[model samples]
Target chain A: MENRNGCKLVDLPESTRRKDRFSFTLLVVIIVLIPVLVESKYYLIVLNIIGLNTIVVVGLNLLIGFAGQISLGHAAFFGLGSYFSGILTANYGFPHWPAMVVAMLATGAIAYLIGYPALKLRGHYLVMATLGFGIIINILMGELEQFTGGHDGLIGIPPLSVGGLTFDNDLKNFYLIWAFVFFCMLVARNLLDSRVGRALRAIHGSEVAANSLGVNTSSYKVKVFVLSAMFASVSGSLYAHYITFISPSTYDFYYSIQVVTMVIVGGMGSLWGSLFGAAILSFISEALHVAKQYHIIAYGVFLSLILIFLPEGVLVGIQHFYQSKKLQRLIAVKTPFLLWFNRF
Target chain B: MSNSDSILELVNVSINFGGLQAINRLSFQVESGQIFALIGPNGAGKTTAINMITGIYPPAEGEIYFEGQVLSGKKPYQVTRMGIARTFQNIQVFQNMTVRENVMVGLHTRSRSEFVRCLLHTPMVRKEERMIRRRCNEILEFMGLASKAGLLAAGLPYGDQKKVEIARTLATEPRLLLLDEPAAGLNLQETHEMSHTILMIRETGVTVLLVAHNMDLVMGISDTITVLNYGEKIADGSPAEIQNSDKVVAAYLGREPW
Candidate 1:
């Protein structure tokens, strides 16, 4: 407290601070310039989809990557958001923005009820529990014809608007979705850098040690699970409003697995890895469309290849590669000179 | 000893694992500001007793009290918040986090911010964060780990890792500290340093409850020693008394022919 260095304890080291600032500025510049630079509407739509997926993946990263809680029923939360928003707006005459809020809250509550019991048990219990819940929700989406519109899907979900501006076009929604994505990333970075964030990583590192230090592992797990569900719910609501149409097939078991895969492909504990995972996987899935009937197999092969080569996900994997290469260069430059001196 | 001097009291506490009686109605008291040692051989329920006191496993019988509050049925975190902290036999530092961050986790109970406030980084949250960091730096400095504050906990030497474990628990500002095997794997010099560290920690006025097998380290630092065998308290007294006790020698130290 008396100030040995005169620097605050909360301040990151100078080098890491510089790097973090650089990356953050770069991200903002990309977000601001993309719409101006790209002229294609189709590309904008795809970018919007990437933004949507990035939001879910960021939240999922906090749960799975940082807090070490697995969630397989994120798709259920996603679907709940879509259905709740769709019914409340298209059928029940509620306003679009209010409907999305309700969707997120409802999904969070549902996740809490599930997580309270599931998180109390260790290991794959959460994985199995969420898997079953996701399947059940998917089935309900098909069977609940009255509210959900059944397998045929729901339409006429009014586009989200504020004041006089309506996000009715791909260009407008591109800004709309990316703004949400930017806010999600900002909040996530803030959380991850703070005391709460440290406790979460501690839980992931060793729950017993964390608990002994008063971190409350189970409660934190449940809280993160709920927060992740809320994130998925927000993404789902955004998707419903953006596309103006959705069906049971969109949010299913496969979608949950896909998002989970994105989290892994991004990196288990890396924040930027979440965004990279979403962008790269989304692009690969779209690119594989050229294979037509064999796209699934192509996608599977691509994922397997990435996993094999970059097991820690792309961002961390690349960082590790760069550092090791630098170390090799150092050895290459120093060892021979030391050997020559030894000969003398 | 009077109840006022006792910081921790285990009253006939018992636990079982299926057919095995891990701890059989063992009871003991740790006096305030004293270095108390629980010594026993392998499988003598030393670690089990520590787990029970920390609420990792609640006692199946009797009660454990800390500062006159019952710890039974409480969660481990709850027990920690009640001013009891512990370190593991196998060092349980958060390997991915820095040494400073590991100690910051020990200061978790002192802060009250939740996820929403943390995400937004409210002014109060920032203030608390700064306070937490300052405390972490102070603790690391005390433990002679300030220079390695940025290094990951996993990168530290084995002896340093153990010190980091103690530094982390100290951040909790515990009234009663439970150290499991503080000198189990240390070499002669490291063990000697550890003995001094324990005495130094006791000088800070924290009551220590240590579980150890090293007779020299235990006798050097501990004011009282309780010997256990087969999950029962075989002998309890001051180090000199236990060293001279016939029962302790027969059950633990082994007797010499007269």
Candidate 2:
């Protein structure tokens, strides 16, 4: 993909000389090994939860990582998808596929409602508005005893199946879920490499500069916000169908915090990093089950340390570290090509 | 080019922020393909005028026309789409982005790839991106930044950072480019080099309307000059005529150039 003058994907520094499909290659290898790697259903199911979170993180990465906007109520959108799909299929006798689609559209409308005008103005209003939305949704879920099954939650949601193949078991659900995860990874990767994603990254740098360069900053922001919510909604639908049970607690402020933590820990603005963030956080929280009393403190300490040392997130920090070392070694070896710039 | 062929016009434009008039009844004409310079001291509303022209803020009292279309009340990106591009005074390069990526941002309006095509990574999108990168490299080469195109813009030296800003704006392929203090922090040698680049840019048939405090650079390259004092145009004329204007000398130059 490198041009004759030695430029590749403009934003990618590592694979500039190469085609830069490293993420895709990594994705293919991971998808092929999950069944072989995990023996127990508990681990497989835990991995599935991580897959669902990964989807949310992928969308959030575009909004928060690339566009530099934060949302504190992603879990509310997740809840919308879960409840909308669950109620339609389980209670209303709708087909699973159509229910999912309807749920997605409904969630999209809600996202538009929140993102359009709420995202119009810049700064902390978005944070406050999303926070307010999360709390309000949480309250509504508790109060709508007839629709949501109230605090007790809902059950009997149908499992997803296509062409008579059902994902009723953990192994079946594993492939079903990871397929979406990697598909999302592919889409997210393609997007970041494109002009639309570049515009988002530009806004992240400085919106004033991006605007002068002909970027509609507010439009991009709203679109990313909508896209992020849609991803969360999809994950929610998947969650409801897989478990056939969901409560308001599943989409509370605490869960929203968990999603944001995943983005920050894995690395913002990276698809692979989102997967890592979700997987690592899920594994840590599950592994600390025996140390239940100290789990929250340990998790906080872990995330804080990562943020302290690698403020850009894990993946970017690693890349930066690796590149700096290579640069130091090259500088030590010879003054090299960049030294020629001194003449200017 | 015809002497009276104006590419951009600010017609009695005025704007205020909380009762402080940033620009007041400012009017000027930039003839097509000409190198026009706006010169004044700090707080004389030069940057505010640039902001108004670029659609950062709508003129509260009048209109701005680019190519005979009213530019007032349009979005910033819309104005940019109409062939106007600009650089910020305080070097606003996407610091974390490499020089190539920064220019790619400037090439955004020029890209015609659809969202689905980009999401699928289709050949058309790939081909379009390659074209943009090629054009970006040429701009970098023109700015003498080709050697450092792979480096992060924030990591570059101050003088080189300024060049990168201009390079990014050039990538937009603007019919009319506004440069705000392109040589503000440069040394004498860098200023000379920047003035050379500005002249070369003008030679490419892209009109340049610049705001700079460096009187020497302004007087040397500007085809026409407009002096602003306290949000008002004090004088507008050819560079030779401006260099001799008593009001310009008394207000802006404050001394004889010779």
Candidate 3:
């Protein structure tokens, strides 16, 4: 009891805290009810895809958004996860769960190896280094014929299951993928509210300031990079298992760019923004699937508009707009004649 | 010999940036519990010396000893954990973070929990968070920023932002606090409050090393003053002695009494 009392954070009034709690519960309810509300098979597939992107973006948010590290090779880790898991489950006859775990571990190990040296490079140099890594991995995925089937890709990957339930269909797989998505979100939120999150954001703000506050900025950067890679790896494993097919082209440089776009569009430094970014971009991509030739151009236009109009993020933009509207309403009510003059 | 009473000593430290000397063979000692001031003009290298002492820059020559341990090759985080904390010259607050969280971050060194513990948010992590948060609250109240704890640090007014910076540093519970221009953009009343806060901090036995271009604040409260000009120490003495020094006048003062 005494320890609990000592641990009481948030000196806020009870009303504000309760309001926050209500909003959070409402958000959780909405996320849980997403599948129930949407029924089209295509939409279901797209939602699953968005969930996969969300898991990756949430981790990327921790790195690029909070820790201020850019990654242009996130797709490499994603591809690695898919390839590793696919080979283990399909060729080596390993269980789905253990294969996914191994893939995640492999991605984490490789990220640590590459991140230790690569993180020392800053700005465009770091971007170039990561881009090179992605291209190398993409090449290896295509050239490795014996294990990965080269350009033909490995096929007939098994579905993931737990105990007695198998996620064998799009709807079932939707549940599986979203389960992981929410779990990742929970983990991200926990990290964002803790000392580690603060240190990472401090590093983003100013590495010098973070170091002067006793944060090991270099090591933290590497750690977050590895963590984000593991997130990508898990998402990749989910992708390979769901699609039951994966070629090197599935995880290309363009995919990495899309991941970064999702982070930027959703808003940096926010979990909700990551989800929104993934959903909006995935919707846009799928909706324009009929006009495949113009998809890239349309994505370019969308990204440009988002960058130019709401660089802070779509969620933040909406919030700002709402707040201004509320302020306008308050002014109109307080001064009736002023509202008439402001009608123009 | 390294004096047991003095907490920090700089033995002829020097640094050069692209052939331009940023700090030149500067030697100074700060007593264990006194408000020591480092005063200089625009380009006098006071902040550079502080940066070197805090491990942001490695000295090209000489040595910095903190409580008898050499600071050479030590990282900034290492220096911080060794009981030194610093504020920045250009207000490097985490623009996106809240004020309370800013202060809580300073307690990163004091936490003993591993990543697993933090990620899991176990009882131990909770206790640590509570303790750190409570201390942050107390620091904010002391700095007159308790009401602004929930606001984004960048959203605060200039004077309050400076106070938030100091409050965050104080959360480290440093034996030696390095404040870089705590009153740079502050008005007169805020500066008065800041000096009072500095006195209270000294009363609590936390030694201070302040870098400021403002001489009035320096002379009013500083137990000792080191005047710098052209990256070199011009005078080191009591404020009155510094005020009377001819070299300090010709280089730093230029016949101005204020």
**Would candidate 2 be rated incorrect, acceptable, medium or high by CAPRI criteria?**
acceptable
- Model 2 segments more than 4 A misplaced: A1-20, A324-344, B1-4, B253-258
Q: Between prediction 1 and prediction 2, which has the larger lDDT?
A: 1
Candidate with maximal DockQ: 1
Question: Which DockQ value does candidate 1 get?
Answer: 0.60
Give me the displacement of residue A240 in model 3, in angstroms.
1.2
Q: Flag the better candidate by lDDT, 1 or 3.
A: 1
- Pairs of residues clashing in candidate 2: none
Per-residue error for B190 in candidate 3, Å, reads 1.9
By DockQ, the candidates rank as 1, 2, 3
Cα RMSD (Å) per model?
Answer: 3.9, 5.7, 4.1
Query: Candidate 1, B157: how far from true, in Å?
Result: 1.2
- As a whole number from 0 to 100, the lDDT of residue A71 in candidate 3 is 91
Q: Which candidate is the best by lDDT?
A: 1
Q: Global CA lDDT of candidate 1, please?
A: 0.89
lDDT per residue for candidate 2 within B1-258, as digits (tens), equals 112489998889998899898788998899999999999878889999999888888899988888888899988998888899998899898997888789888899888875568779899898888888778767777777777877888899998988888888888889999999999999999999999999999999999999999998999999899999889999999999988889987885476667
Taking all chains together, the TM-score of candidate 2 against the true structure is 0.92
Clashes of each: 0, 0, 0
How do the predictions measure up, each by TM-score? 0.95, 0.92, 0.92
